[model samples]
Target chain A: MSVLVFAETTGGGIAETSLETVAFARGLDAEVDAVVVGELPHGAAGELAEHGVRTVHHATGDAFGAYSGAAWATAVQAAAGQSRVVLAPGTPRGLEVLAHLAARLDVAMAANVVSVVPDDELVVTRQVLGGSVLEEMQLPDTPALLAVAGHAVEAAPAPAPAVGTVRELTPEVAPADLVARVVSVEPVEAVDSSGLTTASVVVGAGRGAGGPDGFGAVSELAELLGGALGVSRVVTSLGWRPHHEQIGQTGSRISPDLYIPCGISGAIQHWAGCASSKTILAINTDPEAPMVTKATYAVIGDMHEIVPAINEELRRRRG
Target chain B: MTDVLVCIKRVPDVGGEVTLTADGQGVDARHVGFTVSEHENCAVELAVQVAAATGGRATVLTLGPAEAVEQLRSALAVGCDDAVLIEVCEPGSYGPADVAREIAAVVADRGDELVLLGNDAADTGDFQVGIRLAHLLGRPVVNGVRTVAVTDGVLVARGDGVDGVETYELPLPAVATVLEGGVEPRYPSLKGRMKAKKAPIDTRAPRSAPAGSGRVRLLLPPAQPSTVDVLGEGPQAAAAVVDLLERMGVAR
Candidate 1:
């Protein structure tokens, strides 16, 4: 059985998550081929070959320029003619495309899958409620559609790289598929200089930050640490922070190396997003809070006092 | 005028602890209350606004046990003009495809032009229903949409993407999965609650056979062993924290 992987492109190159999905597909005990909907950067095919992809189906046209879930799914379906299982990155575009394909083919599709045991009956472990719970599921049908969650597997090249053969495939897209294509894009006003998902250090604020004005010290500390500012769902709902900056289930999932949550009680929903962090430092008045108990280091005190002191200490050390 | 339909699901409030059922097929809700997800709340609010602006009817629908009517009633209290309950006998057994197929049948029958759903199910985290329903109905769909507006028979949906704010415009009869924080959801007024108390809910049984995701069991992830070191207390702990940060190489 051959596994078909969808390689989502970024800046003309393959996305890192897509590469991770390819790595996951390589472990499936099936011959893996990949398909790219848009233009592939020169020499990127070698990267896929390094990851053990045997064939690269390149589908490029003006119709594929803009992203439409339906159109991309059409291209992927046309390229998945011989594969028994289809895999894609757990990114938004990847899930959207696979859902469309599953609907068109009248099959079940699983999203955010973390583990897959490939047998005649495929058993997979997937995240539910934003990783707070794990559900073991079986994909009993052929050509099973699965989206591999981010960081499900590490992306690495094989010991011996195989030569990747590029084959052109044309998508038989209908006019209806292009209806939801992107019409325009504009840069969003940044709440912080760095993105929360990619930041090495993240400073999170919560209800204990008091209110909208309470974030001043927290913001300063984040700036001093050169980290992004994230918030609890309560903070967002209270209109203290934008929805994009909320870190939890139904929000952006972050895996920073150092996550310092100030004045936030670590609820299960919020924990789902940051459980992958390497180290957690929780600052709260209540030492019995879930975050404080789960943190690598806990400061049982008021953040209003502790944060400014930390900022001052950092400035002194820098001097 | 375009009629708006908002799809919602009843899930555990999840404010406190989350536990699994004895069989592991569903969440154990004995310790918690139930409500729709935050994004679905925003979807209902947006639906009500769009329907009012277009002089159209705003309808809320769900596929769950009879108790899910509470969610529909809440939406009605906030100005939804209609309610639909496609009562499912085995609530958790209806997978994304089954829910979409059943919802598509209702949409086709009602001739609702615009459909809205939460970006994903809060309980199962399934992201396929909106996209699947769109495909089944042969309509354009956009997910993760935070804001939407209808003008001149075109639907303008905007959402935040990795790089920036992305906008998509589709003709009428489109679908959008909403993310919360786009608009403020209003509280139910006393009069609205009285209205909702008397409102008639259109309830029916599932017309299609069950085709659920083959869920074997639910399991909680192994807890990370945490040993918290008390890094001093009060403002005096700043020096120690700075030292730890410096030792970790995150701060100089």
Candidate 2:
């Protein structure tokens, strides 16, 4: 079965998780193609080519005036005629569009799937109930829709590089397709490369960071380490940070080279986002905290003290 | 006149430890507790507040087993005018299509002027109900909404975006999926609880049969064996922490 991926774009190129999804489809031994909406950024096809994408379905239209789930799904469905399996990242938009497509096609769409294998039947494993349980199942229907679990897989170059072709397939969007359109889309904070998906280093804080004031030291440490600041869902619930900076199952999944989680109890929801990090360092006084046990390195101490001390020590080493 | 409808799900409380059932089809809830999923709780709360201000009626609905009435009663306690349960023999047996089809049928005949749902179900994490229902009803939909307000016959919904908060505007008779942190869900008061105990709940079976091939069985993910490397403890361990950070290339 051939694979079709709905590649999400950031700053005009492919999203990190979409690349990972493409890489994931290749692992299942299928030829991979991609569906891109809106303007094709420079070198877009070339970037996808390195990750095993053979045909880039570039779709652009005025009907896509805003982020309409139906319009995007219609575009994807138009290009999906040739593929047996369609993969989307486990983002809010991805899940919504896939749901719309599944309803339109009268099929089932699996969410947050971590692995897929093609035996006699396609076997898949997915994160369920906030990553606490894994559900394994056989693809019950052909031309199934599956969303790759965020950060669960890593992206790799194709075994043999093939210069792909860009196939423009624009669906004739009906007026009904533009039913849901955004009037104004603004960020609560300035967009940065230090976002969870793109950050090379993520310094995460949790409830044990005390109240909102406790985050000051953690932020200082994150700044000193040249890393992005991440927070557990509790921190956001407690109003310590905005929801955008949350890293967890319900939040943004981060796969950084190094993840420094301070005072955070590694709940299943939180771990689902950061487990893909290359290395994790836990800083907490409770040595028995779930994150401490899972970390590659553990510092059993009060982050209120350890964080500032680490910042000072960094200054000392740099000097 | 404005009428509000909120959809919620009864799920095992995520705060507790989770275990898989032996059959690998669902969670082992033998010892665990249940509660309204976080996001849906906020949605119900938001709908009640909207109905109160707009001089309209607020209704809460769910598709679950008979016991799901517990959640509907909680919604009633919080000032919703009516409650509904699309009774199911076993919950989580149907996929998103079936669930959305039932909800759409209800909306077409008897649902409210505006529909609100959690951004995604906390258990299944399937995010289709709001969008799919919107499509079937021929209305606009916006999911992942954190803040929603009504002004001049338009629904204004805002959600967290990569850069900042995103805002959407749509005419009346729209659908939106509320995010978890939009607002704190209110607790049921004693007086409200008494009313809830007497409140009548409307029960309906899913009108359409499961027509989709999306049935799934739950299983457990393979555990990663963890052995923590204790570098040191306390402020004196500062040097060790710095060394580890430098080794990871996060520090000099």
Candidate 3:
């Protein structure tokens, strides 16, 4: 019952990935502990306690700078203390911290873990080759670091005992290790739009949206659905959409409740990004298009006609 | 002059339908064509460009069977000065940890000021190697670098962050994982290909494989039972589309 989870604080609260990570650790049948960097939001400890975290650990130090992978990993590793496993979400920051932790622990760290089995050996199934393949890694029977894939599971509360006790500890850091502190991270100014990653409904457009002006109906349907718009790599490459809107191996990976990809052939790269959706609805004229074959629903028609028709149906129902 | 080393892998292009081996230990690459991923190809291109400007030699390295020589040759064709193949008899035998170990040894001996790799290998798909190698060598590393350059006495690596381009400046002797963005990898010219064919490539085995081999198996993910319900067609079937949406609980 010894597992430590990094509950990454975001916007002064725990991130969804942190909660999902807590849920994942609980599933391992371990005494889950959490590391809260800043002040926990109101009722957050109770929320974590609800999910089997008995002890909340935080490091007290004014010296640790803002969001550097070096300081953060050192701080978390101090709390990790002899835990059989340490896990975090596979975000850029999380992976960086976990990598440093692995080097310190001298244990193999596995990323993009889909599932873990506590067999005779610690067996981990991970998404490899940009989610094109799944490989099983058998680790040494010892402490391990694992970064779970995004949206691998939903966050649900664990069986409650009590709200966890908060503990203050200090991490010993080598001055040299903190040399490369992240000065600042700024987001590029993006157009006003729904983000592709967290959107519940993602309507993806591909090259088959026809020409640059072919997305009118698709945009109308998206507005009606009140969802985000995603695009395939070809759409971005052709300058029809920005690269930030691309959903593929080299772009944003999304896992919406429902993904409706229009005029997309569903190449392997595009499929890798969106394959985690709860449901997929593909609209393509080609019956043999890979996207159509792999979708939950397929509309074999021009997207110009199908999208407008879908919009019309919604409008009629609303009326 | 700062020597630049770029680590590249030859992967079975996962373009169309993918198949697994009979034993399910690896991708069924027998029939599939092989090529360096765009990510790695761009890294090699960057190394060559950077080395040319700084008067450094660019070395391309890979850990795979002798067949990977073809890939090494491609890197040479595109302007890399030399190549190294850490030949392993069994493919997929060396995981990320092992690859990092072998590369780290070579870097220690060669003393390259800069090392570049694809953010993640297209086949193994692990992002740990660059960071792992950096940790071992006591050097700074920035992953997912879309652009890297030497400016103002420091190496500034810029990658797309959540916001704007996240920039990091490090002293010489650093590692970076390159992503494809600004640089489109160029094809090898006929003269360059001829030069690459005769380029000298060093072949060696890892001094000693690191401990704790963790790979148990490689297999394809279980196929989901696909039921693609045809939700009508064209504009006339809007009625059916509405019905289908309502059934899925998305449309009210």
Top candidate on lDDT is: 1
lDDT of 1 at A312: 95
Off by over 4 Å in 3: A38-43, A60-63, A191-193, A210-213, A312-319, B162-164, B189-191, B210-213, B246-252
| Best first by lDDT, ranked | 1, 2, 3
lDDT of 2 by residue, A1-319 (tens): 6889998888877888888899888887888889988767898789899888988998887876467777898888988976888889888778878877876786667888888866766778877787777777667666778998877787778888657789987689877667567767665444343666688888999998888888888888878877799999899887888776888866777888889899998987788778888889899888988899889999998988888888888888888
lDDT of 3 by residue, A1-319 (tens): 5989888766546788888888888878778898875445766776777777889887757546444566678888888878888889888777877877776566788888988997656888999877778888977635788898887787887756647888888777777566555555656666225777888788989988877888888777777777888899888767787777889887788888889999999888888899889988888899788899889887888988788878987998899
Chain A TM-scores of each predicted structure, in the order given, are 0.94, 0.92, 0.92
In model 2 chain A, where is the ten-residue run with the lowest total lDDT?
Answer: A187-196
Query: Please, what are the lDDT tens digits per residue for candidate 2 over residues B1-42?
Result: 578889988888765367777776678777877777668888
DockQ of each: 0.77, 0.65, 0.55
Residue-wise C-alpha lDDT for candidate 3, range B12-74, written one tens digit per residue? 888767788888777888888898776898899889888988888999999888999999999
> Which pairs of residues clash in candidate 3, taking residues 3 or more apart in a chain or in different chains?
A187-B163, A187-B164, A188-B163, A188-B164
**Tens digits of per-residue lDDT for model 1 on A1-319?**
8999999777767788898999899888778899998888987888899888889999988789878889999999999987889999988888889988998998778888999988888888999877778999898877899999888787888666667899997777899999998899887666334688889999999999888899998888889988989999999888887777889887778888899999989997898778778899999999889898889998989999999999999999899
Q: Report the CA-based lDDT of candidate 2 relative to the real structure.
A: 0.81
* Candidate closer to the true structure by lDDT (higher is better), 1 or 3: 1
- Model 3 DockQ, alpha carbons vs. true complex: 0.55
Indicate whether candidate 1 or candidate 2 has the larger lDDT.
1
Q: TM-scores of the models, in the given order?
A: 0.96, 0.94, 0.92
Question: Model 2: what is its DockQ?
Answer: 0.65
Each candidate: RMSD to true structure?
1.7, 2.3, 2.6
Off by over 4 Å in 2: A119-121, A190-197, B208-216
